[model samples]
Target: MSDLKRLLKSSGIYFLGTALNKLLAFFMLPFYTKYLSPSDYGEYDLSLVYVNFFIGIFFIDIYVAIMKFLLDDSYKSIKNYKEKIIFAGFVVFVICLVFYVFGFYIFLTIFDVKFAILLIFLGVITYIHTIYGYICRAYNFSYVFVFSGLFSALIGAILTLIFLIYFKFGYVSLIYSSIISTIFAILIIDFNVKIFSKFRLGFGDFSFVKPMFFYSLPLVSLAFSYWFAEFYGKFCISKSISLAQNGYYAIALKFSALLLLFVQCFKMAWQEVNFSKILDKNMMSDYYTKAINEYIKFLFLGSSFLIIAIKIIFPYLIDIKYYEAFIYIPFCILIYVFIGIYEFLTNIINKINYNKYLPKICIIYLVINVFFITFFIDKIGIWAVIFGFILEYIVACLMIMFLIKKEFIIKIKFINILYFLLFLTTSYICYNLNFKFIFLNLVFLLVFVAFNYRNIFKKVNLFNR
Candidate 1:
């Protein structure tokens, strides 16, 4: 199969899988807004940000090590170190458990009793599912990987609704559902790969740990800084305004998940392409340049359509009190646009074997993000946070581009600028009209699609042929 075909195929499966796993929270917006208060959502969202950081920090992005060591052009490389990689992952999990025990009091002080416990459980299960799921994908069990996510999401959605509608668990319903679903995902991946069956209790080959940690430690720092920059907004919102106001910010984030649905799929599929093809220098420059240009075009086009769709449909689905959250969606979408680009550059960085600089870039991002939000939140409210992220991604993308200029000549196609213009126009019109100009918004979306359908769907069509 062609590289384009493989990319399309993998992206489709990943889309189906992640659409369920990540976008389930998105699809449940109506039920949540109806059942829970804004403050409740605020609590969950803040806790969620912390849990994500916890995974990145405590898990140490071990999946990245797995990718570096186990993923290659052939299965032989994976088979050689598979058990040891699994053992390394287990060792990391044990270390994280120790941290949890030591840090339990800190979490309790930060969150309420219910949320603190949920945070711990969710963190553990998410770490388990993440590593195991990555191992499954590393083994080329793409079908199993995709299906496991779908099944787990189905269970999560069902359990979430039951907990909310019947048991009245409120925002904690989301917590409970995620925990159960992740367990199912772990079980499914283990069933297919028999991960634990291949392992004995003692550390199998402690030799792998040194190089793995050497490769991953910088990434751990990068992850922490990246996460802090990414989520510092929630903290700003909570401090500057009420937690209920932070809930509105969280709602905007959920709407932005539309872009994330695509971003996550692209990241997973592109990682496969990157690791497989990075050693082939002849294919690196042209393939990466084309991939990025196409990526920008897709992200902007999707952002355009989503902004218009939200303008037309969002008011009805959400609670009246939370309607104001719509104002922030455009900024959130635009942030994801650059986020998509930044992630693409990250792949290039990894492909070029420049992992050391990642920490410096992310730390700079954190500093800029903090400065903007801290300086402006008092004046512009949540827009400070929004603007902080936009600036961060812009600067981060520029820095990465400069660093990788020799290896990858970054180019921006003219069509991508056009996409950005359309996205901007849609956002402006929709924000001003406030659901009043539905026909005009739809027209903008349709005309843009009509002009670029071929360019947009060219690679997508490869899957069918």
Candidate 2:
């Protein structure tokens, strides 16, 4: 198959898998509302952010190195596969376990008893799943990659129902579901590919560990900092306002999961294309430039075309107490928009092996978000959280672009500005229940589609066949 065909096929599978995963989570929200109070859910959300950081700490992010090494054909040919993977995996596990054990004591003292245990146990299982999952994809086990997603989501959703509705598990239903689901997922992947059997008695190629650590060390640091920057808004809301308000903000962001899921599918395909076709770096760089511009154009135009009254719809599915969450949805969309752009831009840095610069970029995001959310949150309310993320993504994207300017040009398409304007107006009108403005929004969306459909279709045909 041609590159275009392979990309489209992989992206299509990935999109369906990701959408199903998000749908399962979305479907569980209403059930969670029936069982857990908003304040209880708020604590879960806060704990989730904290757990994410711990997750990063526990993994050392060696999954990144796993996939990168596997994708490089030349490297894979030279290295003894069984020896390299085993050596790398054992070293990573030992280091992370030492850190986890030491930090477990600190967590118990600082956090709630149940939360601390959940964080440590859940982080371990999740990190294991992540590493195996990346290897599955990097080896072109796309079926395994996609099926594992669907299987995990299905099992998670079922367990969530059984725990919350039947067993009355409350906030811990999520913890129960995650632990069970990840186990099932690992089993499925192991059935298809015996990732663990790659282990040998001794290290045949301990040399792989040095380079892997060098590459992944930066990612580990960036992971912690990037996570802090990403979750700072929720931390601010929880600190500056009530936990109930933080729950509202968290729910508002969940509504943007649709956009995020869509972006995630593209991320999978885009990264694979870059890694697999590493030899054709020059051509792929140009492809990335166009891909990102088209990405922004599509999202902005699609945002204008959306038709959903989240405020009205949410009350029916969730508690009426969170009706105010709808107001925050539009702003949340912008946060995800910038985040998606920054995510796509990072592919450039990864390709060029400019890993050191990644930490500096993440620091800018960390400081920008942490500073604004900490000081201004009390004064400006939830808008402070929104504004901080917008600024963080804007700064991060610009810095990434500036750093890579000497090597490649990433054009911000002219149509993107027009789409952005339409996006703002349409989202406002949709939120406010203004029919006339909604009609106008549809008209402009139609115009955008009409004008750009031909060019967009052409650009996606990477093989020119």
Candidate 3:
């Protein structure tokens, strides 16, 4: 099969899982907003940010390394490599556990008890899922992994609603639901481990273990720096401003993160599949260019929809108290789209083994975020956070482009820009005029779909022929 055909086929499976996951979460947003106060949701959101950081620091890079090593034929037979991988994962998990305990102590001593415990629990769950899920991906069982994620999310959302509405558990419902979901994911992955048992586990081979750790160490640093910079605004808000302000900012983030679900799934599938592809030089370059162009086009359309939805639908979904957050949604959506682009671009660097440059780029973002948030948050409030994110992604994107410019020429197609403008114009008119006509949004979406249909048909025709 052609690379494009394989990409489309794999993307179809991934999209089904991602779309259902996002739709379920989007449907539950109203329940969460209605049951939990903005402050409660804010604290919940803040804890999850810490959870993400901890998972990255603890297991994410190692998991990536596992997949990379598994893909390499040389390390495929290192006797105990699989056992060593599992052992390494256990070691990292232990280290993170110690850090979580100490971190919880400091957090509870200095901050609120509820927030600290909530974060620690969520962090533990995230760590487990990260490790086990990576094992699945390493064996090319992404469909199973994707299905597990969707099932977990659906079950989690249902339980959260039940806990909040029936039991009146409030914020704790979120934590409980997440814990249940992670546990379920772990169980599912563990049950599917027989598919990769052909690879033996050699506990005594320091040779195999050493290279994996060496390759992963830079990525670990990069992950830490990346998460630190990305969450800087939220971290600063939680510290400098009131929790209420943090809550409002969190709502904006929640809305913005809907776009990220698709991006995340794409990254997951793309990394595994792209690395597995055997392509000639010409084919590889052509594939990369086509991928980037399609990525930017889809990103722009998704962001345009989100921007319009925030203006029209978000307020009705959340409480009136969160109305102020609506002003930040547009900027947040743009920032996240840039983040998705940055991720897509970074695949080139990953393929080239230039992982060292990632930390440098992240450090630049950290400095920019800190400088802007410290100097401007007092005067501009939550807008400062939005601006900080915008600056961070803008700088990250440019830095990645500069670093990889020799490998691929990054181009912004004029047609994508034209579609973006049309979407923006229609969204503005409909939103401002309070057009109750559902057909207006549908018409705009259809027009955009029609514009892309030619390329879609061409790809399908290529496969059919």
Candidate 4:
């Protein structure tokens, strides 16, 4: 099978899984908003923020290492590699647990009381699920991963509805739901150990650890810096504004994150395929070129559609109080677009072993984010954070592009740029026009879709074949 065919098949399955998961979560949103107060949800969201940050540190980018190792032909015995990977992952998970226990106490003193204990539990669960999920990905068990994810999400949604709506669990419901989901995923992973049994602990040469550590250390720092920038908005809102405001921002972020579901699913499949194929010198350049072009095209279209939908479709689905969050949707979608580009560029960096610079770039963004958030957020409110994120991503994207230009020259199509600008302008007008219903939104959606029909068709056909 062609690389493109494999990517499309995997991506399609991944998307199906992601879409089902998101749809389940989306249905539960109304229940959460109706039952849980903004403050309650805000605390719940903040716990996740901390969970993500700690996960980044504890995992130390070993997930990337697993992907790279699996794709490399050097590891002849899959069973041995799987065992080693699990052992390494367990060691890291234990270390993270110890840190988390002490960290939770300190965090409680500093942050909201509701999150301190909950986050620690969620963190451990997240760690196990993450490690197991990586094992699944390494073995090219995309369907297993996808199905596990959907099942977890479904279980979470059901549990959350019961706890929050029926049992009156309040903020605790979110944490419990997450724990249930992670447990479900881990169970599924354990059952599928045969697929990943090639990797065994104490079997692979310990020498691999040195190179893996060297490669992953920078990624750890990069993860920290990236999360630092991302979580700053929530942190600032929590400290400067009210928890209610933070809740509002979180809601906006959640909706905006839907746009990323597709991008992430694509990345998961694409990265593995790209790495495996890069060894084939025959069509490497063409593969890179085509992938980049398709990525840019799809991202632009996706962003455009999201911007339009935020204005028209989302209001009816979400609570009236959340309507204000629509303002941040465009900027948030842009952030994900930047992220997609960054992910693509990093493939080149990884290929060339220039991973050291990744952390440096992230550190630059981290510094910029702190300064910008501290200086501007009080004056301009939430938009300041949005603007700050845009600034950080723009810098990251440009830096990655400059560093990787020689290997993969990013040819920016003018038509793509024009459409992006047009879509942004149209979205802004549509947002401000105050169309009473979905009429104006429907009109703009059609126009945007019509304008990009040819490009859309090309991508669809490219993947369909």
lDDT of 4 by residue, 1-465 (tens): 677667778888889999999888888877777777777778778767777876665557766776676677767665466456555544544655687667656866775566576677787778767767877887778788988999999889888888887898787887888898889888897687553444444444554566666666677876687676767778888889877888888888888888888788888888778667645544555667667877887787777666666666676667777666777777777878877877777876777677888878888877887888889988988888888887887788788777766555655556678657855765677667666433655576677677756564565553445
Compared with the true structure, what per-residue lDDT tens digits does model 2 show for residues 1-465? 665667777787888788778878877878777677778888888877777866665556787777777777776566467447646866776687778757764875675546677667777788788878887787678789789878998999999888888898788888889998998998898788767666453355676778788887877766776567656777677777878888888888888656777677777787787667644556755777777887898677655554343533566767667777888888788877887888788866777787778877787777988888888888988888888888888898998888877676677777678778877877777877666766666776777698779764666654445
Sequence-dependent TM-score of model 4:
0.89
lDDT of 1: 0.80
Query: Candidate 2, residue 156: CA error in Å?
Result: 1.4
> TM-scores, in order shown?
0.91, 0.91, 0.88, 0.89
User: Where does candidate 3 have its weakest 10-residue lDDT segment?
Assistant: 195-204
lDDT of 3 by residue, 1-465 (tens): 665666666666677887798878878878877777777887777777666666556543667776776676665656656666666655555665787667655755675657566577777777768867777877767788888989899889989988999999888888899899878877787777742233234333444556666666667655675566546777777778877788888887778887787688677767776667666655556677778888878877777666666666786688787777766666677777777888887766777677777877887887887798889988987788788877888788788878866665565566777766755665565456655553577576768677777777654743352
User: Whole-model lDDT for model 3 versus the true structure?
Assistant: 0.72
lDDT of 1 by residue, 275-352 (tens): 877346666667777878878988988888888877766877799989989988998999888888988898788767
Output the number of the lDDT-best candidate: 1
lDDT of each: 0.80, 0.75, 0.72, 0.74
Could you tally the backbone clashes for each prediction?
A: 0, 0, 3, 18
Clashes of 1: 0
lDDT value for model 4: 0.74
Of candidate 1, the 10-residue stretch with the lowest lDDT total is 72-81
Alpha-carbon runs more than 4 Å astray in model 2 = 200-204, 279-285, 305-315, 434-447, 455-465
Weakest 10 consecutive residues, lDDT, candidate 2?
Answer: 303-312
Which residue runs of candidate 3 sit more than 4 Å off their true CA positions?
57-60, 77-97, 195-205, 239-241, 278-286, 308-316, 406-416, 419-427, 436-445, 461-465
